[model samples]
Target: MTVPSPSAQPNSLRRRLMLLAVGCTMLAMPGAFAQEVAAPATVLPANGDEIQQFCTNIADAARDQRYLLQKKDLEKLQAEVDARIAKLEERRAEYEDWLKRRNDFLKQAELGLVDIYKTMKADAAAGQLELVNPAIAAAIVMKLPPRQSSLILSEMSSDKAAVLTNIISSASDSTTSKEPS
Candidate 1:
């Protein structure tokens, strides 16, 4: 005959457990019911050595996971820095091209302007320069030949001449070009 499974039994596990509890209560003396049942003793493992061992076993894995997360963060930051540097490099290249075009235009214009002033009479040139921007007048005077420049300065008012002289002198001064320490 084939044996039946525990679930096929006539009494279930809960029913059997309840019947056992009732039988034990009936067997006890009536005086025992009057006395309170003492609580079961509680047992605790000392110093938690098992918990410490479990933590120690997983320590290396936890540390590796932390390091992996930090590495990903650093890599992300590095990529951002690289992208910013690339943008700055592009801007610098554009700036250099613009500066070169500006300088080329200035050189061509400066040569033509100086030639026009040089051909003029010294008194007339000085009178025209007096009405121009002081910086432009000083630049033209600086570029002219020493004898021509002297003649033009002599024709100018003493105050205007002194100012031009100071500008020209300072423009050539090496100390002014040096960066402060």
Candidate 2:
């Protein structure tokens, strides 16, 4: 006839876990079961108290100076914002110029490649272009006069030729669309 331990009861683990969870939640909740305590009142200057009144006036002036300093800080912050925006715009313009120069260089290089490819045998040019970037291959084909492009495409595998044709056509369409009416 001995008393059974709590863990010996049915579903004891679940009950213990639930009790622990509830206890943790209660402890985690701020001011749970806490009593409210009143804060001590601040002493102020009494009527006709000269020294206390002077100190209060000085404090008020200091507070006003702090507010003025904050306004000055805001002005400085605005100037900094304007400076950063100017710098960002300058950087963006530089980036655009760099991109344009890079595009011009690539165009010249592509034209040179087209001349080289045109002099090669059609089958040889097609084989070399097959291993290069599809976009570059497509560009070279476009740069070649139509007769040479057709000969190169005919020499390529049908699937590769079809893909390059599609790329070239789409590129022309995009350029045409961007041009002013």
Candidate 3:
């Protein structure tokens, strides 16, 4: 058997038949042949009066939708803020409770310390207090009896004695007036 040469006329005929078959196949498929047409664009108003009239027609509905969205956004923000405030309040309560317990412990310790300082000899007490925090030393000195305090002050350095004396006087002053007491 001999193979025939591809002729130009036969090639053109074949191509045309193939195109016709493809066209028929496309028509047979509902989607290919009947694709939805693009939506017709609405005509925009030309003049200012016509544009204003269009805007006026839809104003109330547009405003209501915008307002609704804003309201929802505000409500969400309010809820978040409220949650944060609640968390802060809980933390504040925890802090206050911890502070109260710490203060209570310190108060008991301070009383014990004051008692110990009261029992020590004035010279020894002055020596020990001088090594301690000035405010604490002053507070201890203030708690001691007048005679004991005087003895302690006499034993301490002049500068230390003066500071302690000033602290003691200031602590004792109960006047609520703005003037120096």
Instruction: Please estimate how well model 2 matches the true structure, expressed as its whole-model Cα lDDT.
Output: 0.69
lDDT (10s digit) by residue, model 1, range 142-162: 778889999999999999999
- Computed on alpha carbons, the lDDT of every model, listed in order, comes to 0.69, 0.69, 0.67
Estimate TM-scores for all models: 0.40, 0.38, 0.37
Runs off by more than 4 Å, candidate 2: 1-111, 175-181
By summed lDDT, the worst window of 10 consecutive residues in model 1 runs over 38-47
Residue 169, candidate 1: alpha-carbon lDDT: 77
Model 3, 3: alpha-carbon shift in Å? 99
Count clashing residue pairs in model 2: 0
lDDT of 3 by residue, 54-88 (tens): 45644665676678889999999999999999977
90-132 in candidate 2: lDDT tens per residue? 7667666655654653485475797898799889999988888
As a whole number from 0 to 100, the lDDT of residue 159 in candidate 3 is: 92
Which sequence of candidate numbers ranks them by lDDT, best first?
1, 2, 3
lDDT of 3 at 145: 79
Write the number of the candidate with greater TM-score, choosing between 1 and 3: 1
Q: In candidate 3, how many Å is residue 141 off?
A: 1.1
